[model samples]
Target: MVRTIILALGLMLSVAAQAQEAKRADVEALLEASNMDAMIESIYAQTNKMFAGMGQQLGIKPDEQQLFDDYMNEVTSAMRKEVSWAKMKEPMVQIYLKHYSDKEIKDMLAFYQSETGQSMVKKMPAVTQDSMMLSQQMLQNFLPKIQVIAEDFNQKLQAHRQAK
Candidate 1:
């Protein structure tokens, strides 16, 4: 009976593994069909634009061409290290299998291949740039307040330590 149960469990696991493999292939195809390369280009453009704007506002004028090169190089290197693309793939694949059927991802990929989708891909940089600008502004506005809080907290800590 134990041997029979073990065989049955192994079969169940094999079937589940096959299903997962199919789902993973479908998710990877969907991700690739979404024009990931173009999306990455847009992201780089957005980053450059954001940094340029921030540089102007912050009044730090380095050589533009060298700055661009260095920035892009640093970003590329960081992405290769930080993203852990293989690990990231798992959660995304799970989400796809959970929320999106293979048919849905296929349809979405089809939509992304359309003219409107292409336009969206083109225009996303500006939207992303604006968001970065907003974030920079918020950080600029909040830094002083954050510093004050930190100072206050430090004072309290010091007082507590002295009492102790």
Candidate 2:
């Protein structure tokens, strides 16, 4: 009975591993459709912001849109097929399998394939763009305050050294 049980478990595990391996690429492709492009675009947008600020600060005007587009084009040129199998799937699958059953992954995939899920995928780039802009704006807003604090600390250190 013990041997039989072990054999049965082994077979089940093998089947599951195969299923995960097969569906992984499909999921990766779906994730890639939005994820990869969004990541590249984000890089472009940040670069655009940096150059725009530099142009303003240095009195050298950079064509913001053109600079952004040019950087995006360069990123696209380097884009290739999936980098690796692991890139397609989060490493948490091993834990997911341990915690959640096969049914959960399938259900999640099914939901993701649904209209709402499709819409989320479609809007993700815009969502990422807006979020990135907000985050960068926040960082830029904080910069002056950070600089002030750093300068205050530096002045105090300089005074202390002079007194010593």
Candidate that scores best on TM-score: 2
Runs in model 1 deviating more than 4 A are 1-29, 45-99
Candidate 2: residue 92 lDDT (0-100):
36
TM-score of each: 0.54, 0.56
Kindly list the per-residue Cα lDDT of model 2 for residues 51-70, writing each as its tens digit: 55554566544556567557
Model 2: how far residue 99 lies from native, Å:
11
* Whole-model lDDT values for every prediction: 0.73, 0.65
Q: Which stretches of candidate 2 lie over 4 Å from their true place?
A: 1-17, 23-26, 29-104
Q: What RMSD does model 2 have?
A: 5.8
Residue-pair clashes per candidate: 0, 0
> What C-alpha lDDT, on a 0 to 100 scale, does residue 159 get in candidate 2?
100
